[model samples]
Target: MNQLQNQVSPYLLQHKDNPVHWLPWGNEALDLAIRLDKPIILSIGYAACHWCHVMEHESFENQQVADLMNEHFVCIKVDREERPDIDHIYMDALHQMGVSGGWPLNVFLMPDQKPFYGGTYFPKSNWLQLLNSIQSAFQNHKDELQQSADGFAANLEDKSIGLYPVELNELTPIIPEVLAKISKYLDPIFGGIQKAPKFPLPSLTLFIESFPEKLDTNFDVYIHSERQLEKMAQGGIYDQVGGGFSRYSVDSEWFCPHFEKMLYDNAQLVYVYSKAFQRTSNPLFEEVVNSTIHFLNRELRDSSGLYFASLDADSEGIEGQFYVWEFEELNSIIPYEKHAPFYQAFQIKRNGNWEENKNILFKNHSVLNVVYEKELQTLATVRAKRIRPQTDTKLLLAWNAMLGSGLVQASKGLNNHKFLENAIALEESMIGFWDIKNNLLLHQISYSNQPIYAFLDDYGSYGLFLIHLYNETAKVIYLEKLRKIVNGVYQNHDQMNYLFSFQSNLNAALISNKYEITDSVIPASNSMLCELFFWSGILLNDVTYTLRAKDMLAAVLEQAAANPLYHANWLRVYSEWMENPQALVKYNPSNYAKNELPQLRVTWVPIVDQSHAFLLCIGDRCLSPCESIDELLNQYNSI
Candidate 1:
């Protein structure tokens, strides 16, 4: 029987039938281990992780492993996604233990539920040996094991939970300084930040774009940002042969990719690229955004407009197999007439662009840039014929909401009606389909299917998305949905005095009493929640939500004040809060329904209640209800 018989997470349910009598992490499991005086074996992984699947098949499925686990220790299974707080605590433990960590994280905890030993996946033979060795140590060196566990527990307790804040004034000047410093770090001959194994730092690129707004309008800053953006747009990091970006390049020149593609990266990159196009009027940047959109539509997005998580780095048991091309293969596939144009567009050479005569994808002597419109169209058609990698179809709520927000932003920036439409459709899917009758979000939805219950981050992000979608379309329904969800989140998750936990039920896994501000694969749930309260207050004319927003910020203000640069998300929130807030309220939803508004250069913030009064410095501006839609629009735009 699997350890996850009655568990909530689908990932945990997958291991229920494994030979190991794996116990889900809980009080009962911990209590049993404590009573038996046995070490706890905690195995952590996610549902879609490929290597996690491999380890299960190789070692966890074995009867010998199960027998050893049952007899020698308490075995526990943890789904990293379902319980990130638990994952964070253990990951920190592994770091302190001087061991590298990855999924499935194999950690041996003491009876008290503190990790004393851990490593990632080990071969089945090696794993069996390890089990025997650990069993021996606990039996023969019981005192030694107790001492180590006690020391580890003490060290963990000593680690501080206090937050530090970075000052906004200090950050106001640092953007230019960082831009200059970053310009020096850029590979001049090739585009990208520094040397090989180039991860696309979309954040850095966007920072460079915003540098001028934060600093002096020096031409150097302008020119440097443009050059960096242009070079990367044309290079292999951009998927010159295909249409979308790989995760990163293995080299500084944006050549030789790591080859995985993530929906979050593409969504953020599209917003950045589209904005760059607007700022510089660079056709190449425009092309990059357009191609990336095509890639998302073709592979990433479900029918509802929510995007899937990722495409694997490997295909057919080999890394980059689906993406890499050979000279002979290219020649064999293309006719003589089209071959020259194709070669020029992709920067292909007879010697090949990568190691061992394979094209890692970069232009050489022939292709200066993808200058012609016809050329790009032709390449897109040809590239579509190639074998594509399988995509991970699990629809994560936070990520989907992020893509929804990004697509809506991009649509506004590019004046693309389809992108806006896609955003609306996605919002409907999340609100109408994913929400269980229990008034909570489902975290993962199958591709082209209905969603499951949502995570803490889901409601927070979706709430924010609803607000943004309202800004885009000026639909009352969007705002109304946002209000309902925000109220639901506050009532369901909030504790007294500005605290919120991840789980709706107090009996569910205890995540945290305080906010976690760290930006990981997704922006922090706490940060998004803070934003929802702040904005909802402005749009609705409610003071309670606004005050609650301040309380949440104040709770962590000290931490953010101490480390402003590292707390980018907090700083972003602070910047808006401190600035003269501009509120745009349109009463006539119909006017905005068909109109294509020029993209606002400012970060468009949609606030409802009385929160806008303080930010806009328009105290009690309009107490009387406006008689007409035009009057409301005018009053809203005045701020």
Candidate 2:
């Protein structure tokens, strides 16, 4: 075993047995690179990446390849989940080189840790040839390589100099143009954007939810949203027997998936489905929400009441082995009477839809029409006997907070108190991460038992969830915590207006700090921070917080206006900013009946206080306080 054997990350532990002498990314690796006069080979991947596994098996495990790597380089393995700060810097470097980046990121860095060259995955022959070439170039043309490295490092530094505040322009007209651009990419047949490998970009789904009127009237957004949700519900991307979605579909039809389930994806998806149900009152959306919640509760949640990071895509050395099934195996497990309905509903065929005569169960029919629950149970029972995929047990604060927020949204939309109870419990559990003395929120908790200082996402996402909890329970404590955390975010940043991806002091080894503007698989941390600041400003009556949010929004508005799909989260913030009239519902607990609290269809700022009345407010203006819930609803509707 190498240095990885002692590491806490499951991804690094996976490489412990490989023939390659791997070192975890740290001072030891850097020192070795300098002392031995070798370029550092930095490989970044997570436990759930399929291509990561493929490259590991092809190159890292081979003896000859290992010998070459050990001789020529200080090979460092970085689990991207564990140290996203490192991954972000190198991935940015790849983009600077005009290379499209993906997982299994391989970058060659100088001893001083400046990245010079990188690419994603490579075949064994190609990888071997590339290694020799890099080695030869490093030995023969040291001056040229150093010049290239210096230039790349300079570019990264230039990009890191903070965003400047632009004047806020009318974003209302740009909304229609953004929607028109989004409409051009929509697959009229399949639902999502017209792309081959379809990902459930929750940001897009969220944009649909927030801008219902704009999309529904002009773009048929409601119809398209339903189609997309239905396609995912019936597709193999969503586990038919089990109860969650995979990372994405490898095909445009959502027929075949990469088959890794991530907490962040499911959490945001639950919020999306819940909102869809709220809009349409569709039973299908409700079903998806409930099933997804069940999956999270059963598989991801630990005894600590926090959710795990993700489940691996492979099981027992074969990708999708645990999830996929042979037609004959299904035929034997399912009873005769149930066979035909199950087969017809799930598109089971003799030829098989996937590789090695295996079928990834799916239904092309309407999700509402499908009724094969009993058959699914039988299949699930049999599949349980097989090896299950490994779960990455690390608890990330941002992801857990996301799940908590989703549960709260689901609870409100579906009127299911159980989901609300779960969200509250998760909030209570996460309180341990709060450092009252230092005013810090730890990013993650792992087996190592060390406190990883929080990143921007940790503060933004968890802070947003705290706001949700405050709305649900009317608890002042949640609001107080939200304010404190948001304050910490500002304190950690050099500029008070915008947030950086990592805390300023954390990840000091990184070449530059990154500002996440575009939404990725998860919404940008900065966007979430902006929303938190905006809401906190209103709830606390703080002008500074409000102005900071507006400044950050103004800086990103031009970028968002140009390509709204990528900046969906930013657009959501802009939407709320433009439509500044927010309803503030103030209610007294003693006067109003517990069941009489208004069920909100539109977003509102709910406050619980000692006053025995309800006050409706739009911005700073307020209507006279009313005694009855019905009176409050009536006044709100009139506006």
Q: Which candidate gets the maximum TM-score versus the true structure?
A: 2
Deviation from native of the Cα of residue 436 in model 1, angstroms: 4.1
Flag regions of model 2 displaced more than 4 Å.
158-166, 169-172, 212-215, 335-338, 368-370, 435-439, 447-450, 496-501, 580-584, 609-612, 619-631
The lDDT of each candidate is 0.65, 0.82
Residue 480, candidate 2: C-alpha displacement in angstroms: 2.0
Task: State candidate 2's TM-score.
Answer: 0.95
Q: List the residue pairs that clash in candidate 2.
A: none
| Shift in Å, residue 463, candidate 2 | 0.4
lDDT of 2 by residue, 1-639 (tens): 367887888899889999888998777788889999999899999998888999999999999999999989999999888777788789989999999999999999988888888999999999999999999999999889999999988787535333655566543556667778888888888788789788989988788677737446776667778889989988998988888999999899999999899999999999999988888898888988999999999999999999888998999988899999888887778854557877877888777888989999888877552367777878878888999999988788899999999999999889899999999999999966766677677777653434567878888899899988887777789888887887778666545335554545644447776777778788888889888888888677687988888788887877787787788888877765664334566666556544666676445455665364877766446788787778877887887
Model 1: lowest-lDDT 10 consecutive positions: 611-620
State each model's C-alpha RMSD to the native.
Answer: 5.6, 2.3
